[model samples]
Target: MKNVLILGASGSIATLVTRNLIEDSRVRLTLLVRNPDHLADDIRYDSRVTIVVADVVKDTAHLTAAMQGQDLVYANLYGANLKQQAQAVVSAMTTAKVTRIIWISANGIYNEIPGRYGQWNAQMLGSTLTAYAAGAKIIENSRLQYTLVRPAWFSDKDLVSYELTQKGQPFKGTEVSRQSVASYLSALILDPSQAINQSIGISEPHTDGSKPSFY
Candidate 1:
């Protein structure tokens, strides 16, 4: 059985991944969330799931304790302290001797989004991308095996249609479904070698435009 730890477990995409992973009999999950109340009863009561309520950025000792005996850690947190959170996660994982992690980041952090959409995205995100970029850098520099996923804007649509772009390649499309990101994350956790030590971008197949359709 594979032991999986999910940080920021209450976030939208993380919740989807958590629900799907719990269905796998061979996988045991440890969910770390800032608020236990943010989780659904099904997740809260599952026999395969262990819930740990603590802020990853502020609770390094608790985070390290949760990392013990885990095979993989998937981080899906978003906050102003993005860089500090990344540092804490890397530190805890390193201390626990656990390797392999999947990090959710933002597109355009590397100026990989092209043309008008790139400019518009930059204009919209501004300094927020600076924090994200700094956070991603820490992950990239870590010795832990990691796949940093920079996804286009999110959608609530149920479809899992999406495409992948490597780090140096231009970002594609305008948006992708949260379902797609969650499903892809589950696949990576199930098979860790797929995109080992690479940073990737994901988006819907043909939604490209000046901006995300939603905006």
Candidate 2:
């Protein structure tokens, strides 16, 4: 069985990922969240799932210990302390010798995608994405195998489809469902060799063949 640890496990997208992964009896899952009480009851009852309480930026000792013996770590934390949280995860993983990390950033952090859409996303994210860029840098410099996934606007609706592009290509399509993002994250966790040390952007397909949700 593969042991996987997920930070920010209470998040909507993360919760979806957890639910999907839990259906697989062979996977051993651990959730590191601020409040374990916030987790849904069904997830709490699962034998394969373990819950740990820890704040990503503030706590490291227990978090590091919890992460020990895991095969991989998925980090989906956001907001201002993102970079610091990434650094801490790196440190813990480095200490524990857990070398695989999958991080969820957002689209347009690179400024490679052009026009008003990219600009708008950059502005919408504000300083949070600045920290995201720094976090990506830390992952790039670290010894661990990493894949930074930048997803476009996410919604609760179920679209059931998505696409992933290489780092340089502009992410295409409209808002992807949060479930789709979760599905992708779960896939990355299951298969690291295919996605290791890469940055990917994800979005849905559009009728006009142009990526939507730009504005």
Candidate 3:
């Protein structure tokens, strides 16, 4: 069976993708989390699941151990030290000989969004985008095969309707459901080659506005 390791696997999208993988695919999962309590019982107790408790940025030894036999490493993480986390993961993966990864990032990191919404997004997320952009570069420069998924503002909407825009193209829509992003990530688990060595923007079909509808 394909072996997958997810760093920061307790987040909303990561958890959803974790659950979906358990039900829809036979891949063995290794979840790295800061707190085991953050996981659902389904994942916490699954026979095919292995929980590794450690912080992605602070625990290099544990992280390296987790990547040892992993076929794909998916990092759905965030923080002030995201660039540092990228450094740690890259070092560990190289040591373990794991070569493929999927990283979750935000859309404005590339300044690819347009119009009033783009200005607003820049004004709102500029500080956060700096670290994200730096972390993305760390992954991009690595020899590893990587797919960076940049999503629009997130929503809790239970829908899975979404579209994509390539890295150099303008981003679409103002918001996308977390479910849709999870669905996209889940698809990547079965086919890590789908977006190899590329970055893609993902968003809902036509929820464009001055800002995300909820905001």
- TM-score: which candidate is best? 1
Compose the digit string of candidate 3's lDDT tens values, residues 61-133.
9999999999999999898788999999999999999999999989888889999989998898867888899
The segments of candidate 1 whose C-alpha lies over 4 angstroms from its true place after superposition are: none
lDDT of 2 by residue, 28-126 (tens): 999999988878888876787989999877889988998899998998787787778888999999999999899888887787556666666677778
Colliding residue pairs in candidate 2: 173-211, 173-212
User: Least lDDT summed over 10 consecutive residues: which range in candidate 3?
Assistant: 19-28
What's the TM for model 2?
0.92
Off by over 4 Å in 2: 207-215
lDDT: which candidate is best? Answer: 1
Better of 2 and 3 by TM-score: 3
lDDT of each: 0.93, 0.82, 0.92
TM-score to native of every candidate shown: 0.97, 0.92, 0.97
User: C-alpha displacement of 17 in model 3, angstroms?
Assistant: 0.1
